[model samples]
Each structure stands twice: as structure tokens, then as C-alpha cells.
Target: MKHLSDEQLVFHHYQVSDDGHSVEAHLAGCEACRARYQALQDVLSAIPVTPVPERSADYGRQVWQRLQPRLDECVVPFWRRLFERPSLPSLPRWWLAPAMTALVLAAFLVGLFWSRSRAQDTLASRLRQELRQELVADFQSALNRSQERSSNALAALEARLANDSKAEARQLVQALHDMLGRARAEDRQMLLAMFRNWEEDNAAAYVTLRQDLEELASLTDKEMRRARSILVELAAQTPPPDPPFRINK
Candidate 1:
């Protein structure tokens, strides 16, 4: 025979099943069904039952009173307020068309002004960049020209020095004087100091050479030949160039 289902057992336990008598007869005959029903009753009975706290008659009123301030502070959004229709004076129906046209015109004017200002700013920036590039190019060109002139002047000075003639020496002195006249005060002072040092070294070399030449006649043939070779080597050596002049801004 089929045993009573858990649903039938539960309904029978609660005294709600329509066939409670038949379920009870089945449980009495089947030991397995009776054991299952007992287990279900034990599980339900193991659960803890809680009692609800009693409230006073004015509980709802007290809750509503506590929440009323917060509700009053609730801010309705702008869009919702618009939908609720705020109390403002109504405009004439015919004025709407002209007002819309004016709004569109204002927006167009603002956009046009902004675009023009941006264009002007861009143009100004481009012009400034171009001006800076031109200035740099001009500065580089001037620097190159100055370097070229200085090189040429040094080459001429070297050529003059190579000549052993008194005329060449006079020309060199004249050229230096001309340069000193054109130079700034600080450059003139530096050039003068360099010239003084060079003059002292040259004077000393000249005195030494003169003494060696005078003593050559008293020396033996082999010693004279050695002295002549030494003199030739000294004459063959080139003098060092003067410091290059630079203009400081």
C-alpha cells in the first residue's frame, strides 16, 4: 500500500487535511510512515518560538511625528518642480514665437564671437612663433659673419708675422692700433695686455739671438755649424696666434 505523503502528514499534524482519518489509519499500520511523521514533528518542535513585543496605541502617531521633519526637509528636484508648475505670471501666447527667435539669435551671436576670438588668438600665437624663428636665424647669421671676420683677421696677422721685413712689422703695429680704436674699452685693455706680453717675449728672443750670432765667429767650425742649425730651427717655428676677440652682449 502507498504510504501517506509528507504534505498529508503536515496537514494532518496541523489538523487541516480533509482525509485526516485515513492518514492516521495509514500511520498506525505502516511503521516507516509513523517514524517519518515523528521525525518531522521533532524538527518543528526544535525551532525556537519568539514572542512579538506589544506597542502602545499611539505607536503609529509617534513614528509619523518623528519622520515628519525629515519629510519636510526633502528637496523636490528642479525638473519635478517644473512639472508641478510653480506659481509664476503667465506670458502672452503670441510672445512665445518672438522669444524663441531672440534666444536662437543670442546663441548664434555668442558662438560667432567665440569662434572669432579663438581664430584671432591662434593667429597671434602663429605670428609670435614666426617672429621668434626669424630672430634666431638672424642671430645665427650674425654670429657666422663675426666668426668669419675674426678668422680672416687672424690669417692676415699670421701672414704679416711670417715676413721678416721692418715694413711688415710696421704694418702689423698699424693694424693692431686700428683694431684697438674700433674695440670696446674692455677689449682694448685685454689686447693691450696680450701685446705687452708678446713684446717682452720677442725682445728677449731678439737679445738672445743677437748674443748667439756675436759668439758664432769665436766658435770652432763644427760648433758654428751646430749654432746655425739651432738658429734655423728657432726661425722656422711659428709664433702663437693672439686671442680671438669676441663681442659680449
Candidate 2:
């Protein structure tokens, strides 16, 4: 006789069972078919309804007799007969179904969100680094640029101080010497124009000069202080900028 197909073995395993001789033969001789049958059995077993209550042999005969009238009436179609017992085959598949569901849920969450794993840093530590880098860089760049502008400005101040009618004034002479060679020409001319207009009509450049002066003053006091105070403790012993160049006749 021809051997049974897996589908036949599966249906037999679930809705019905083959005899012990066929089961043992399949297990001993055909491992593949036997494994498939066992898998089908596991899946089917997972969705177990209340086991049909054991009754006397008359019970099956009674069910057959009741169904025979319905069969004759053709009240239920063939497909409906196929599903007199509900089956959720996709759900209870030998542990694989649960695993597949979990895998899909995990993939969806991962697709929706990219969790930033900062095993590289602790919470406060990461915050500190981010703040330090951002604030320090901003402060440092602004400090350097303002200092550059100040160097140019201090130079012009010295030049004018040196040229004062009272050239021998102690504070003026000292400041002139201290500020020698620092102010750039462009900056000096700019400052001169500012001062000249400040002299004329005094209020002519009020709004324009007021805003400029405020910004410059803020750089000098607020921003520069914030930037410089950060470094004061780090190198308190170090001397200030050395002045090596001298250009005067």
C-alpha cells in the first residue's frame, strides 16, 4: 500500500488518529513524516477546547443520529460542515506563533524609535559634557574675538593718550606706554570718527552710537567677564600678555 501524505497524517493527527501500527511504522521508518505529524499534533493541542465529556458508547451514536437529519435537509453547506469546530490555525503553532508575534512587535518598535544608547556616558556626566562643550566653545570664541577688538581699541586709546597736550602726565604717559603698538589703524580711524561725531551735535548719532556703545560695553563687561573668569582659576599664576613689539620714532 502507498504511504500517507503529510496533509493526510496532519488531518488524521488532529480530527482523527491512525492506528498504533501506522503511528509506530511512521515513527520508526519515516522520521520526516513523523516529525511533521508531531508538530501538527502540538499545534492542534494548544487550542484545546473542553474535551468532549466521556460518555457511554451510546453518546457518539446519538450525535450521529441528530446530525443525520441536518445532513438530509442540507441546512449547512459542505464548507460550514468543515468548520463546525472553530480553528485558529495561525495562532497556536508549536511555540513558533508566539515567537513570531514577539519578533514582529520588536521590529515595529525598533522601526518607530531609535533609542539613543549612551553606554558611553552616565546621565549627569553626559549633560555636563554637552554643556561644557557648547558653553565653553561659545564663550571662548566670543572671548577671542572681543579681545582682538579690544587690542585694536586699546591701541588707539594709547595713541591719543600719547599725543595729549600734557604729554608728561603720569597716568597718560604710563597708559600710552602700556598701550603702544596695540591698536590697529582701521580701528583707530573708526574710533576717531565715532568720537568726532560724538563731539558734533552730540546727539546726532544718539540711537546708532547708543546701540553700538551698548554692544561694545556688553562685550567689554558682561561677555568678556564671563569668558575670562572661567580661566582665572586655571592659571592664576601666569603673567598677562607680553608686549614685545615697539614702533615709535
Candidate 3:
């Protein structure tokens, strides 16, 4: 058999009943259970209870009398209290649609203005970019043209300088040739003049020898013929004068 629980004994000691009568029957038959219930009753009886005080019928009147002066001192006017609470007045059913329509119209207007401003900004930025691109292209084209002109000018200057240098070189060579030809002609003329002086001196000596030979007729005729032949060979050996030198400029 199951023993009675302490909760059942506690409820019984308080004169409170539960859903079953098993605890009362067990207390009557079991001495241990009955003694436990008696001990629980004794402990509950030993604790003291604080009693609630009763008020007289005039308690509310007394409290109202004491708080009335303070309430009056802190009281606000009707208009001041109305503003502090800030309650909205009731609106007619017809007002709802118009209020919502006004709110939506204001939002649409703001969106349209914002979109227009954004589009204007985008168009301005595009125009500025196009202008900048055109300016850059123009500058690049001008620079290319300027560079071409400078290159052409430099090429012409180089060609002119080359032609002048060639002309100067030709002139210098011609002058050198003329100088060489003149020196050769002068050397030839000096050689011819030296041979002529030698011829004259030999002729005078031969005349004196002939006179002496006439005086001394003891020489043989064969020796005289040999001497005359030698003199004729010497005169034939003299060279002619050179021609004048001419150089084309």
C-alpha cells in the first residue's frame, strides 16, 4: 500500500479537502501517518498570524480632506491640460482619401524635381567631357602639324648645306690643280734656260779652238772631222722651252 503524502496531511490539518478521502482513512488506520499529521498541525498552530486592521467609515473622507489642498495647488487650467495631452480631434470619413492623395502628390513632386536635377547634372557632365575631348584632339593635331613643319625645314637646311659644301670642295680641287700645273711649267722653262746657257758657252770655246787648229796645221784631217761631229751632237741635245700653263676655273 502507498503511504499518505505530507501535502494531504497538511490540507487535512487546515480543514481543507482534496479530490479523494484516502488520507482520512489512512490516518485512522496507520499510527505513524496519524502522528505525522498531528506534528504538522502542531507546527502550523505554533506560528503567529498578523491580523488585518479595520478602518472606520470616514477613512476616505479623512484622506480626501488631507489631499484636497495639495491637489488644488498642483491643479492645471483646462486649456493648459488640453495642450499637454495633445489629443487629435475626430475627422470626417471623407477627409481620409484627400489627405492620402495630398501626401502622395507631394512625394511625386519631390521625386520629379530630384530626377530633373539629376538629369541636368548628367547632361552638363557629358557636355564638359565632350568639349574636353575635342580640345585634346585639336591640340594633338596642331602638335603633329607643327612637328611636320619643323622636320621639313630641317631637311631643307641639310640639303642646302650639302650643296654648298660640294661646291666649295670642287673649287678647292681646281685651285690645287692650277697651282700644280704652273709649278711644272716653271720647272720646264728653268731647265730649258740652263741648257741654252751651256750651248752658248760651248760655241765660244769651239770658235777659239778652230782658230788655234788653223794656226797649227800639223793635225790630220780625220781628227778635225771627228771634233766637228762632236760639237754638232752637243748643240742638238739642247731642249725646247715649255708651253704656258692654263687652268679652267
Model 2: lDDT equals: 0.77
lDDT per residue (tens digit) for residues 1-249 in model 2: 456676677656654664656666766687677677778778877985887777997988999999998678756688888879865545445899889899999988876554433433467688899999999999999999999999999999998877885755877778886677465666888999998877886766677889999999987898778778878865787878768987789
Clash count, predicted structure 1? 0
- 10 residues in a row with least lDDT, candidate 2: 112-121
> lDDT value for candidate 3?
0.88
The TM-score of candidate 1 is 0.32
- What TM-score, computed on C-alpha atoms, does each candidate reach? 0.32, 0.21, 0.31
Best by TM-score: 1
Candidate 1 lDDT score relative to the true structure: 0.89
Weakest 10 consecutive residues of candidate 3 by summed lDDT: 13-22
Give candidate 2's TM-score: 0.21
Ranking by lDDT: 1, 3, 2
Model 3: residues >4 Å from true position, as ranges? 1-84, 88-98, 165-249
* Best by the lDDT measure: 1
Residue pairs clashing, model 1: none
lDDT values, one for every candidate? 0.89, 0.77, 0.88
Residue 193, candidate 3: alpha-carbon lDDT: 97
Better of 1 and 3 by TM-score: 1
